[model samples]
Target: LERIVADVGAAVVVCEAATREKVVAAVPDGAVVVAGDATPASGGEGGFAPMVAPDLAAVIYTSGSTGEPKGVTLTHGNMSFVADSIIESIDMEPSDRILCVLPLYFGYGLYQMLTCVRLGATLVLESGFGAGGRIVQLLEEREITGFAAVPTIYQLLLSLPGIGEHELPHLRCLTNAGAGLPTPVVRAVRSAFPDARLYLMYGQTECQRVCRLDPEEVDEHPDSVGTAIPGTEAWVEDEDGEVAAPGVVGELMVRGPHVMQGYWGNEAATDRKLRPGRWPWERVLATGDLFRADERGYLYFVGRRDDIIKSRGQKVAPREVEDVLHAFPGVRDAAVVGVPDDLLGEAVHAHVSAEPGVELEAKALKRHCAGSLESHMVPKRIVIHAELPRIGSGKIDRRTLAGWSPRG
Candidate 1:
């Protein structure tokens, strides 16, 4: 937080009571530091301030999965556009109540609150997703109409006893983003919420939402991230910047009002991302993610261009292997990476954590994956760890694992 404030040259800092002194000491001289819970002055009138849609609203930092985090500048229009699109796509109602388990600092969690307020709905904010049973209890007690989470959250929820047996009639929708949910986990979610609509979404911090798959299409296109959201255009571009044909892998590009203005104080990076479009006045985001499109225009994530692994003259996505690993019974969490190998160029390696009291053998895991994954997609090596490392976003810290050695 301090680094971000310093980098952005913020004029004021608002924080909770516990962090007021720290924020005051860290902010620039003459910068105001206000308590988040402080009451307004008596003379102050309460009303909406006059502002234009293009005015800056907030700056969100990327998760820094690849390298240093970059601050994404968003305007009032950007957030408002995304919130409205999501509300329409999910068919949110004014009386709907949402249960948010993600951190408010993250875009996925923040949008839940934004959408609720826009629709005049209720929001039940939890600090984090605790034990599965506790979350189920909250669902039953609160009568939540909507639930939002990432793939890992659903995996944990499905691990709980009597998960599929529980009745959640009030939960009308379940939305997922951050990373693609495995096919098995998607099935588990369906079983858990039989009557609810399951929405598989794809996005980044730069754009709050890019695409959304309808519940009816889940069975037909289980791997697709769906088409572009309303008022947005998404496509895959080849190395020469031409639109790639269906089933051809290329970087994904998105153009919409929800796209961020640019990276704060990073013009070079901004130029690389927000580049020229078909028209001189238009700018589209060149997402560094690799993806493929179906004949029907549904998008499927391949992998991050930098994260994609080359082995045996073929490309492999870590998520694809990780999905297979997650399907094995008693597996709690899993992460896949490419390791240096003279024979295969880059060998597929997996690190998995098991549920408490469950024993996992590398040989058994390999045998389990052999049934589903292609021979080239199977892990060359498997390691069992007590827990998989996670960063602030609750995503597996692949960079840390990439350089890790058991001997060290």
Candidate 2:
């Protein structure tokens, strides 16, 4: 955003605290300044004249590994539209207190911040999602009304020793994102939080969130990624370019106010995904995920495009294998991948991290898979690593850790 202000022939006005005071001062004073959490004792406004920009608001960046990260520029109209939509769909009230662990830079986390600010609710900011004890304590301390996290945190929290029933009663609800929750993890979470609402959502960074499974619909249709949020349009397009019939796999596409404008400085990437070609709307964000819709209109997840594997002319979903692996005793977490093969086009491989002191061996785990999975579906090899690879957001980076030799 600072770069955008400078490159767009405008100076950036920033507000910061003592630690960031030097950073903001470095910017040209010719730019308009606004103080955030760093105002003087009197709380007086800056002397500079306020400049108004219509529909345009600042962008927040998350691509930390990349050089010179750019912000996602969302207009005022866009912000108002999505925020109103979320508040309406979830029926958010001013009394709600959200436990926010995600930082403001992330759109998911930023929406949490915006929702709290707009609803006049309390935002109990956490340093991070490390374990359950701290969070359990905070929920009681702050009377937290809600929570949100990716699947990885769900697995960790579910596995924690003290996260069982009665530890957290004040939690009104919890949300999951970033990745799909394995069925086992989902069931485990249900057991842990018997009272709190559990919403299994599916979405990408390009679009904040599209589908959400409400708490009531969980038991009747736990696997279904709940119907599209109100005020949003959802359709699955097959390879033939038409709405997919019920029970048929298709690419999930979402059209709504929450969708992002485009990628930063990457017009081609934006054009590839956000094309308004066939959709009647002004824009649509095409998700790469493959999912099937049941006759009743609930969305059922299959797997990611890159996560599918083909073996001996038969297509296979790695998640199916991973799901079976998770059901096995002693297995803590697992990621399945397809490796190169001589007979088949690809060979199924399983990489797992087991519970501490569980005494699970490669052969025993293989036997466990053999009992549940078909002969063809069984993994040819299993690799157990000490720890899984993690990206900037602390979720598993499978591409980086897959195929690496297991820990001795």
Candidate 3:
């Protein structure tokens, strides 16, 4: 927060009681500080100049897993387009009440609030998704019509006993993003909320939403991340800048009005991602993620290009191995990475966190993978951790894991 305030040269800072002192200390010498919870007194004329849609709205910083966090500058138009598209895709209504469990600073959580406000829907804000019992209680008490969460939250909920037995008739929809939910977890989610529509979405901070799988197609295209969301065009492009054929993996490209302007104060990074599209003036987002599309246009997220493991002269997607690991009955979380190997260039390595009281042996896990994975796809080394490191957004910290060395 201090760095951001300093970077932007913010004139006023608004924060809650808990962070008021910190905000005051962080603000510039002449900057003003306002308490978020303080009631406003009667004032004179407060009208301000009208702003346009293209005007700057918010500057959200990236999680900086790959490198330094960059400020993503979003325009009012960008947010409005996203909110409207999501509202249309989800069929949001004035009567709908959304349960917000993710942090408001995260784009997913921020958009949830924006979408509800745009539709005049109710938003039940919570500090975070607490225990399964607490969340279940909130669902029943607040009569939540929709619920949004990342994959880890879903895993936690599924770990709880009697989760499938709970009846949440009011929860008309359940949405997942911030990372793909494993197929097994998807099944558990469906079983838990038998009547609600389940949406498996794919997105990034650069583009608010790239695609979303329809509830009806979840069974048939369980592994797919679905087609492009409303008002966006998504495709996979090869290194030569040509569109990839179905079943061929390539970098994902997204072109839409909802895309961010650029990374604030980083022209090189901005130019790398926001490249010229078909039109000379139009800039499209070249997402570093690797993906393959089916003949029907459904996308399968293949890991980040840099994260793809090169072993035995074959490019292996970590997501593919991670998915298999997640399917294991006792595995609660899993991450796959490539480690230094003199022979293979880089060897496949797996790090896992198991469910409480579940003891997973490396040999047994290798034996389990031998059945479903190809010889080269199986992890060469499997290390179990009490809990995998995660970022603020609840994504597994691959960067940290990539640098990890086994205890001597």
Candidate 4:
């Protein structure tokens, strides 16, 4: 098949008939294209020697700071270690079935699939999220025991006109990641899927899952991202370069088996992200997030460290925007931040809260920001909110702001 001949070294299975033909046409000379569900009928022997190297398991693509996509090469050992860590921590069972809406291209989604396959459990896949109706239907029809998604999915699903608890009887567990979830949306999801275990997961493509929350402890510690996954170490480093104590906010650093080997073919980025021989895994992924751990070592993710803008060349954290907004007469919550611009490197963007029955004006909020924050920190654009978009795992859908609406 073309994939085989073109040095697409990974062993790819053709799930659909048309896809099979395409693979055959592409690499007709060398590929062993296994078609259909029946493995024995295709002259196949079990446990074929892994065609990939020990340092290669799956290559997942992700968007980086350069505005270009990059492929992250994770070894089989890298992936296997993380999978075992997840299984060991959560104690997955053979009967578990996850209703998977995540795309295969995502490392998290692929991890879910590989984890299921390795554990001899089933992962029910869906072609699309469709709507709350479709998700509700899938839960009943497929008897899905687990679910996982980003913040956007949650926002879209919760907006469905007709949804209730009866529709999600089989959803035993759920996970949220990709972005940080808003507190209100997280509360809403917990109310809807009360029976299902909810975990707020955090990770990057460089390293798959760095942390996972315990469901029972959600209400007790709504802001915390939970303890480090087994085989993972998380700590806050102070500005002076020492480990921070409990409740002291600082840069979050992680060293674990799940940390990636390196960015494919980019030594500069690889060296920047992965510190060699740092621990048992020999690599530690430096997360850009600022966080603090509780006395018990439960980690709380604050926000991105780079999100803070240097206004008038003076550093300003976006959390300050949210802090100021909450002080307003009627505001309950806020997500103040910066967006890229041609001239300013970044421009302030404020999405704020409104009191019940009180219409908040952009001009008024703009004045409020001007009074509360430095002139440079005042949001150039003000967006009033009835509700902000969130995804399934209860995170803000900041990507939706690409087409933000300006209010009077």
Best by lDDT: 3
Clash count for each candidate, listed in order shown: 0, 0, 0, 13
Q: Which candidate should be chosen as best, given TM-score against the real structure? A: 3
Which consecutive 10 residues in model 4 have the weakest lDDT in total? 1-10
Candidate 3, residues 1-408, lDDT tens digits: the string is 778888777877777889889888888898777787785443458866698998999988877666667789999999999999999887789999999989888889999999999999999988867576788888899999999999889988888888888778889999998888989888888888889999999988887899999999998887788999998999999878898999998999999998899988889989999988889879999989999998988999988888889999998889999988988889989999999899998999999999978999988888888889999999999999999988888888888898898752
Would you give me the overall lDDT of model 1? Answer: 0.88
Instruction: Give TM-scores for every candidate, taking all chains together and pairing residue i with residue i.
Output: 0.91, 0.82, 0.94, 0.75
lDDT against the true structure, each candidate: 0.88, 0.73, 0.88, 0.71
Task: List ranges where model 3 is wrong by over 4 Å.
Answer: 21-36, 39-46, 406-408
Q: What's the TM for model 1?
A: 0.91
Worst 10 residues of 3 by lDDT: 39-48
Candidate 3: Cα lDDT at 151 = 84
Candidate 1, residue 290: Cα displacement in angstroms equals: 0.9
Where is model 1 poorest over a 10-residue stretch in terms of lDDT? 39-48
Segments in model 4 whose C-alpha atoms lie over 4 Å from true places? 1-53, 64-66, 276-281, 312-314, 318-346, 351-378, 383-408
Better of 1 and 4 by TM-score: 1
Mind giving the per-residue lDDT tens digits that candidate 2 earns over 22-43?
5564555566555665444433
Error of 4 at 352 (Å): 8.8
lDDT for position 264 in model 1: 97
- What are the per-residue Cα lDDT tens digits for candidate 4 across 331-369? 644676667777777788888656446678889878888
Return the TM-score for candidate 4, rounded to 2 decimals.
Answer: 0.75
Query: What is the Cα root-mean-square deviation between model 3 and the actual structure?
Result: 2.3
